[model samples]
Target: MLLLLGLGAWAEKAPAETSRPALTVSVQQVNFVDMERTLSATGNIRPWQDASVSVQTSGLRLKEVFADVGDIVQAGQLLAKFDDTIIRAEIEQTRAAIIQAQASLEQATQNAKRIRRIMGSGAVSQQEADQVLATEKINQAQLSSAQAALVGQEQRLAYTRLLAPYDGVVSAKSAVLGAVYNPGQELFHLIVQNKLQWEASVSSRHLSALEPGTKVLMHVREDLFAEGTVRQQSPALNEQTRQAIVYVDIVPGAQVKAGMFVQGDFKLGTRKVIAVPRQALVLRDGFYYVFVLENNNRVALRKIEIGQSLPNGVEVLAGLVSGEIIVVKGARFLEDGDMVRVALAASETAAGAGSVMSFARAGR
Candidate 1:
């Protein structure tokens, strides 16, 4: 009977002594840290100014194309050329007409002077003198008309050579060799100054915070980013969407092109928030959870609401408070109300005398 009672007592104590912790985990306290706040928006890349280059003269055959699509050109650079053979011939004819008119006017003036001198002497009749004066006036008017016509012809000749109106990149080209183009027909389309802008649609409520000169960061690709500045905002909001257009001028780069849709963020300064290390959180069933350390080395798995992502970790919007001890490492292997062994840091081991009291309480 004594042996039986001793064995029973040993059996009752063996289970507690042999039981082991579920896992060893590192713990940390949640704390507040300053984090940058931003408002996100999506928009398209577009040229700052789109200009069309067209011919101003009619019936001119395209002689040569100097610039094609994607060519960078400076102001007044020749883009294309017309035959100019007909224009040059017309110009020469006009010059000849001007010369003829000048000669006729000189002769008429000399005759008119001679007639005026003889008018009082009766060597020339009054009617003949009047006719000479009138003839001189007619020749003078003819010379003026010819000079104006010569100017018109020279202008036409200049029009045969098409030039860029400003510094830009050629986006389109329609000028073809040997094709006759008429006046006001577009031959090329240019992106003025090769500049680009982002046209972002932002909510009306957020419009008040955006202004000219505000900084912006745009994501061009997975690993690429471009910086931009806010240029202006639409004066009115869209009636149907209640969103306003914000124009942001981007720094010129080869990666960006007009009409490419991209995502971007507007920097609105910073704010303070409670955050934890990224590894401390566990994801399950579309919800995030953290293992909060409870009394007696036990952990409670609690659901948390997350907000903005930070460089150090993620913002915990709810379900956790400051000064709460939470599992940082080995949290995924833990379940609710599981007993754990807290890995003591080097400092805690150094002050083992002070931790003895806490460890004794945890053993219970």
Candidate 2:
């Protein structure tokens, strides 16, 4: 009879041991991170340096253009050509005038010499010598005028063959084959210097945190990316928008072009973050809670101090630790002292996953 009673008691204890809830669980070891707080804004990539080439002189139709839009050109490379018929004619005419002026100057010079000699002999009047000197002056003035005309023609001729101002790619083209353009007109836009800049904006409230050499990340569309440094910042925020402008210089990067739009986190430094993942948080009674797994895999209903909710996760300022696993996939049905499972490893969570959260184990 005693043996039967002992067996019955042992049978009851066995059910208690085997009655523990079976939970599929995952685990992770958490770590503390020192990271920069990135401020993000949308802006454009522009040339760090751009020069607008224009026609300085007006002229007739040209033969053809030697360079086209999007053409890579070097310094002094021929870009376009113009008809030089009028300039050539002008140059020839000026040359002829110079020859005539030279002959006249020679004649007047000899006349003055002859008159001076005769005056010493009392054979010629002083007025005659004076007239000869005036003729010489007139010849000199004529020569100067002809020389100036020839110089002007030469300059016009040089303008016919347009050249790239520097080593750059042609971004735009306005001049075409045999087209005549007026003064101050654009020809070709060049950007091949491969210099690009990113413009970032900061709100008035966060302007004080921005600094020179503050690091930033830029996400160019189509998977093309470029690294740019903060080169300039606006002195004052705009009154209407209340935002400050930041200029970032892009390093030579793959597939990054001038004037392409990009957006990303820019502010670089550490700030306080209240962070948590989507699944671990439960909305109950208009507040957020987590089924925190304790040391021995038991769960407790814990109230979390949250700041902001994000797309991927939430920020938990005061309710978690670095190395605790909170129920990620299924925690909505958990109660105090209930057995729960952590579906994902805390250590395996990526930096972008969300806030770090700790779980408490429940015991019966």
Tens digits of per-residue lDDT, candidate 1, 245-358, equal 999999877478898999999998888889988988899999999988888888999999999999889998999898788888778877788888876656766876322111
Q: How much is 229 displaced in model 1, in angstroms? A: 1.9
RMSD of each: 4.8, 6.7
Can you write out model 2's per-residue Cα lDDT over 67-124, one digit (the tens) per residue? 8766778888888777888888889988999999999989988887788677767676
Off by over 4 Å in 2: 1-31, 34-36, 117-122, 205-210, 267-278, 284-287, 294-298, 305-315, 322-325, 336-364
The candidate scoring highest on lDDT is: 1
Error of 2 at 102 (Å): 1.5
Query: What TM-score would every model get versus the actual structure?
Result: 0.82, 0.77
Off by more than 4 A, model 1: 1-22, 110-133, 282-287, 300-303, 330-338, 345-364
* lDDT on C-alpha atoms for all candidate structures: 0.88, 0.72
User: How many Å off is the CA of 250 in candidate 2?
Assistant: 1.9
